[model samples]
Target chain A: MKQDIREILAKLGGLPVSVDTISDSADLYTAGLSSFASVQLMLGLEDKFDIEIPDHLLNRRSFASIDAIAETVSAVRAGQEAA
Target chain B: MDMQISLLDRLFDSGLLIDTGVEGVYARSGTFEDVITAFEGLIDRFAGNTGAEVIRFPPGMNRAHFEGSGYMKNFPQLAGTVHSFCGCELDHQNLIKCMAEGSDWTEGQKASDIVLTPAACYPLYPIVARRGPLASGGALFNIQSYCFRHEPSNDPARMQLFRMREFVRLGRPEDVMAFRGEWMEKGKELMGSLEMPVEVDVANDPFFGRAGRLLKNNQRDQNLKFELLIPINSVANPTACMSFNYHQDHFGSTWGLKTADGETAHTACVGFGLERIALALFHHHGLDPKLWPASVRKALGH
Candidate 1:
């Protein structure tokens, strides 16, 4: 999941540095992810994971880092399965 | 709500505002115009020496540029586009007939190539970008325009059509931040000179929809916007008379704006809500400018 997240970030994040250069807990915003790019990243993640991120999870924390994003995707998938 | 309606009624009754039978739209009387003019002069006295280029644009801007600005993507609810009845004589006849029948005559109106200017600075970026790279010292501009929004309300401060006076800076991120910081202080001082109580607080634009929630949160978390608030119609929710925004490379990337060194330029703008400021003066002082405090009068050259 983390590798897939890094690949998506590389394509859509518009960061100045490589995604692999940053750790899973590294702040994406600090790594040059812009508000506009973050939106694009969110869309890319949705397409890649085939998961619908709920409105409540659409915040900075959900996309703060790769770890946070993976956790959010897990939670959404869990909710989907339970339903 | 009573106070809001009463204030609107009083302005209409006192001839300060002429009723046009439409909510959030009114004609300003000579007295009201005078106050706005004086306040503008005061602003000039403060920023005139900054050597900023002065530009004025009509209330409508090119529709293509408006689309490029991405305003619709964020605040689609507040945007207003200009439309016209562009059809043959047969269609015109039908339009007239529809209007005569008290039906939706505007349904046939086609979207024009122009949209109402959302803010004073919206039209500046493209013009600046067309001029090539910025100078080493960057660029500063003084602009004022009649802005439009779709929100209609009884609060005099929240007009559907109003004037916004803005000073925009384009350059490095540090310089842009400094410009906003300087104006934040200058804004408070300018308001203080009029003896009006004020507060500065972080703010975010009313972005639209569920995706907008993320944008709003990101903006607030980064402290990208601030507003100088003064009580006007309601004390509980003071009106934002002035705003300072730091668009770090957003406009630069969108407009292809570049610095002398070929780097993406950061942009910042400080905007003063002219009508809202006038309303605040009237709310704090007496409606009659002649009865305002001596210091306030002197500051505005009233």
Candidate 2:
């Protein structure tokens, strides 16, 4: 999940640095991921994971890093299954 | 961006914009004023039979209303408040002394009851909410105001204080959506008549911070906002001359605005960036209005 999320970020993040240089816990915003790029990344992640990120979970912290995005996707997917 | 420098120079040289020695501030010449007036008249002609109630508010609005509008949470960086030197005699003396000494005299000023209006429609919702539920046909308002943003920029198109002509609709979801749709088309038609090549595309407000990114994306994903963009300075990056926005029930929910049927009223607004449009006209049509195409002049009633 982390690798895939990283791949998604690499594709849509528009960050200055290459994705491989950053760790899963590294701050994406600090790596030059802008708000518009983050939103694009969010859209891309939603498409790849096929999970709807609820409004409550839509915050900077949720997309702060690869690990955070993976956790959010897992939680949403888990919620979908439980439902 | 390079062309903008020459355009600004032309505006100043043509006396269309009076230089105020401020980066983002300028006074409009009479011809400039007439052009905006003609543009507004064209808007009126376009909106004919819409039965929109015309409401004009002062440039400043109640500070409390500004706070209640949640503008502070969203775009605090752009918000401007009215501050005055409300001090005692001794403080006033110190203020004078500071001014004479070339010190920060404005530091002695206190925040007043009003804030420079951030948008034309910010004051309308509370007033409408106070009137109870909307009528069956909903409400349509034609409002214009001098909006202020704290942003100071060298770009001539980006003025700190500018005018926005907006048509606001509040009612059922379908009604509001239809209103937005009709204006989006009418806006395109209006620009077409003026010979301004434009494209309407989905847009989002420059929402602030991390949470704002989500809001912006949600807005675009829901197709709530559309902007009619025209190339004034740069073709690669066009400017939004007009915007058609459907707020769904955001404002209604915020202000407890209800429909006659007792449900939250949906709201939408179409705003024309008056100065930007005028700048685009001068940019495309040249600095001289007389030299403009006869059709463009006729369309603008210039």
Candidate 3:
């Protein structure tokens, strides 16, 4: 899941630095991920994961890092399975 | 809500504003114009010595530049584009016929090269970039323009077409942030002189749709925007009379604006909503400018 998140970030994050160099907990915004790019990243993640991220999770903390995004994805997938 | 509507009605009845048969659109009387002119003079008194370049743009800007600004991406709901009837003679006849039939004649109108200027400082970015890299001391501009937004309301403060006076600063991030900070204080002082109630609070633009929620959150979390609020329509939900924005290389990267050292420039702007302030004064003081407090009149030089 972490590698998938990184792959998505590499494709759509528009980060200045390489995703490989960034730790799972590294702040994506600090690495030059713009608000515009973050929205793009969210859409890309939704498409790749086939899970709809709710409006409540659409926040800075949810997309703050690769680890954070992975956790959000898992929560969304878990909510879908329980339903 | 009743009080808000009455205020609009009173302004129209007092001849301070002329009713234009459209909500949020009104023609100002001469007295209102005088007040605006006097307030503008006061603004100049505060900021004129900064040696900022003065540039005034028309209410409409180049469509291509507006597209590049990414305004549509964020607030597509509020953007207004200029469209013209570019049909041939045959199509013109059809358009006339459509109009005569009391149908929608505007369907054939094509998009023009212009879009209503959403904010005063928007047109300045591309122009400044064309001047090449900024000087070591950086650049400051005094800009004013009639701005447009699509939100129509009975609240007189929320005009569909209004004027914005802005001071834009471009330089390193620290310089830009400092500029915004200085204006935030100056804004408070100016309002203080008028003896008006004011509060400064972190704010965000009305970014559009679901994705926009993230953008709005990030903006607030970063403290990128602030507003000086004054009660005009309601005290509980006061209107934003002034806004200070720190773009932090958003415009710099978009416009290719550069600092002297060849780094991307950071930009910040402080904007004053002229009509909103005038309305706030009337709402807080009195409908009659003559009856306004002596200090308030003196502050505005009325």
Candidate 4:
């Protein structure tokens, strides 16, 4: 999951630096990821995971870091399984 | 496309729209004004039976109201705040000196008590909420106002400052949805009468930041918003000339608005982008309104 996230982050344009040096919990916006790029990244994540991110989980906190995104994905997947 | 450039050039050449040397800002010529007025009159005739409370708000609203509206939360980039020079004598002199020296003088201006309205119906909510619960049939308002946004684009259809004519309804979930549905069909018919081919599809706002992406998708998936699009500028990328949105208790929760049964009042609005519609007319019928098709002219009551 972490490797996939890293690949997605690297592909997002407008990120000032490489995603490797940034820690999992580091803020993506502070790392220079723009809103447009974040949207692109969101679409990419949705495609890769084949899971729809619910409205409630769509916020700055959810995309603040790779770790946050991984948690959201896992949570959504768990909910799907329960359903 | 070459057609778009030619259409824009024709509008400028015919003096229908006087360019202001700035992208997305223009002074409408008398002919342009006439077309807008005609279009509005046609809307009025169509809505004559509906007892909509007509209201007109100034281009700017109270700054405090703006801060509380949560507009900055979603569209901070497009929001425009009014500023003025409220400094004393010494500060004024300093500002003048800075201007003379070709330095930044605008920094001396402070934020004013007013902010340019981003949407036509923004100021209506809190006022309506203050009136307590809505009546049995719900509340309906006909509002028109000049809205300002910071989007500077070369597309004449998209202006930084433009007028929006909106009919806002607040009531129960079913009532608001019904109203939106009725208007969705009505808006399409109105456009067709003008001989403009329009397509209605679910759409989303350009929300702010990462959360905005989610909100946009949620809005689209839930079918909260729909737009009447026409191929004005380009056939490939049509522009939205009118929009129908269902804010299902979003404003009710925000403004403490309630229905007669004490539940949060659901809200919906049908907004017509006036300039875009006029531009669509020009695009479809060519530069001359007089030479437009007889069906279109009769539709506009020519």
Candidate 5:
């Protein structure tokens, strides 16, 4: 949700990048995020937060940017806690 | 089964499958006739040996047919309707008045809506429902269905008018799966015998939009569908030669189809793209049917 995080994610291209440059609201597609790269990003986020993404959540909206992606992750986590 | 039956004897000589060109809608170009003939022969031989009776359904289904079947709930985008203006009258005066009122009408007319059959199986359900349940065990229907879709892509593989040569088998859950599995194997075997290269893998229907994407993934995970893919021109993205699907009690429940013990019937179907297959063979091999390799020609009943 931080502006710095959005800037970092926006610059994160198709290739793996240092965590320092990652942002929360980056435009993944405009930032050169390929389909394969999105999968890679999913894996990285799973490792970072220890949250497993269900297969159904694999889509454009889930990978649009760091802020959107974080919102989904938070929602999933909150749902898990409530359950 | 390997009786070396004459091509004509197997099909066209009281052949089970028929060749139809609904206003050139379903016909192929530069090789459609020969392809239709070949598919007719192929399906006739296959269906005849497998105990299926050929049935060519009407051009379209009725409006209530889909409404009763919950088609509008499941797939409204693919549904099409028959429309006509019986009588009407309109003029510039009417147009001007409508424009001023922010309403427009060309004429006043009587219109009734009729649903065009989405898939070949839509109409079959009603017919079978009226039959008062299939005999004790199971039944297989041989259908060469003409179907239409709105978003017919220019990709020759996707056509507005295409023939879905379907083998609809209904019975218990196990029976439906077995039928689909058996035909999946048979399709591969047939393709192999014809010397055509093919691959069998999990397949999907052209479900529409966002929700459809989720449904398609669910279909894959449930193993409800499989496809026989053959390289039509490019080896990278192959055309789906055939699809074997098991609909577990979906249609049966909708139509109230039941077995002897009173449980809903399980249904499965294997679809062959007759014209698409023809295009593949013609594109790969040439237009001359006689010149095709012996095994290939015989497989297609050339």
Candidate 6:
């Protein structure tokens, strides 16, 4: 799971990089995440997981970090499975 | 090989256009250069003979300015951020945690609220009316400004921060229509010149919920907003680029902008959503903007 998170981090180029260095609690936007790169991350999330993200969940909270995003993806997957 | 809309979203069911749908990056970078390029060509073709003098505006504005202009009454929802100071000492980290953990601070209320401007035109009225006017001639301005809105959607197409490049003129009603008319014709030509697959249509602002349903009717009756929509993600629901608006003495009366004869100078403005256009162009051409047609590349000066 951490490996998956790492790979996702790698794909997010032009973020204040060095995926090997940062901890989970670090603030991404204040630490220099450009809004442009965030869209790339969103697209990658949609394509990689092969799941649709609803409009309601489209916000900074869900996209803040690997931990937050992974939780969101798992929750979405679980919801899909439940249905 | 899939060519159906998402039944889940009625608007999404039309078709998904990927290129245009994805140019979110370019749009936020800045929308003015393209708008200016398009406007210059359009004005030369359409407004050249109308004797439109170009005026530039001061960047940014103050809250008192808008209050004086009645912006708070009409558009409270869309006002931008204002800077404010707590006018008190910063609490220690422990104090912050204590408050967070449900401990109340001693004898404290929060600071005052200053405001940011939401519209590009909010500051124009006060400046125009400052000299206690009676100039016989009408005024025309080419303004590019940073505009802010607290919109519901965070779609790249709908952004918190965006740029607006506008052609605004204050004159008689007939003159305002003539400017809009000239831009209307040139709007079609400019879209074609860029080879964007688009249509010109009337649109209403996302005013709100059930009440918003009637926006289209009102917009049509008053001819408020128009857009050139190129499908993003091939979705038939279009994004608005050019918005033409006529403020029939609403702003003029609020600010007391008067002509030599002492009537409110009719105000009209043509607004270009800079980022939206960049998105349209990026999607219409390829994402690798460097590889777009030479003419398009030249048109964008890229």
Q: Give the TM-score of candidate 5.
A: 0.68
Task: Mark the regions of model 2 whose C-alpha exceeds 4 Å error after superposition.
Answer: A1-70, A73-83
Just chain B of model 5: what TM-score?
Answer: 0.81
Task: lDDT for model 2, please.
Answer: 0.89
Candidate 4 chain B: 10-residue stretch with minimal lDDT: B209-218
Q: Cα miss at A17, model 4 (Å)?
A: 42
Q: TM-score of chain A for candidate 3?
A: 0.97
| Displacement of the residue B254 alpha carbon in candidate 3, Å | 0.2
Docking class of 2: incorrect
Ranking by DockQ: 3, 1, 4, 2, 5, 6
In candidate 3 the C-alpha lDDT for residue B104 amounts to: 93
Candidate 3 ranges beyond 4 A from true positions: A80-83
lDDT of 2 by residue, B72-110 (tens): 867888999999989899999999999999999998899
- Model 4 stretches astray by more than 4 angstroms: A1-83, B1-3
- Give the per-residue lDDT of model 5 (tens digit) for B1-302: 12212221232233322324322243334445676677678766765577776788765777787789877654777766775555425455665677788884544433355666677777787788788878776888888777776654434555566777788988888888888988888888877776778999997676655444545665676688898998864577888978899888778978998877778898999988876777666556655666778878777766
Summarize candidate 6's per-residue lDDT along B115-207 as a digit string, tens digits. 544666766778778967646667777666677776644254665556677787787778777877777777777777778876777766554
Give per-residue CA lDDT, model 4, range B242-295, as digits (tens): 999998777897899988888889999999999999999988898889999999
TM-score of chain A of each: 0.97, 0.96, 0.97, 0.93, 0.68, 0.82
Tens-digit lDDT string for candidate 4 (A1-83)? 98898898898635889888899999887897754566777778888888877767775666779999899889888988888
Q: Interface RMSD for every prediction, one decimal?
A: 1.3, 7.4, 0.8, 6.7, 8.8, 13.5
Against the true structure, whose DockQ is highest?
Answer: 3
Q: Model 1: DockQ against the native?
A: 0.62
Model 5's CAPRI class is incorrect
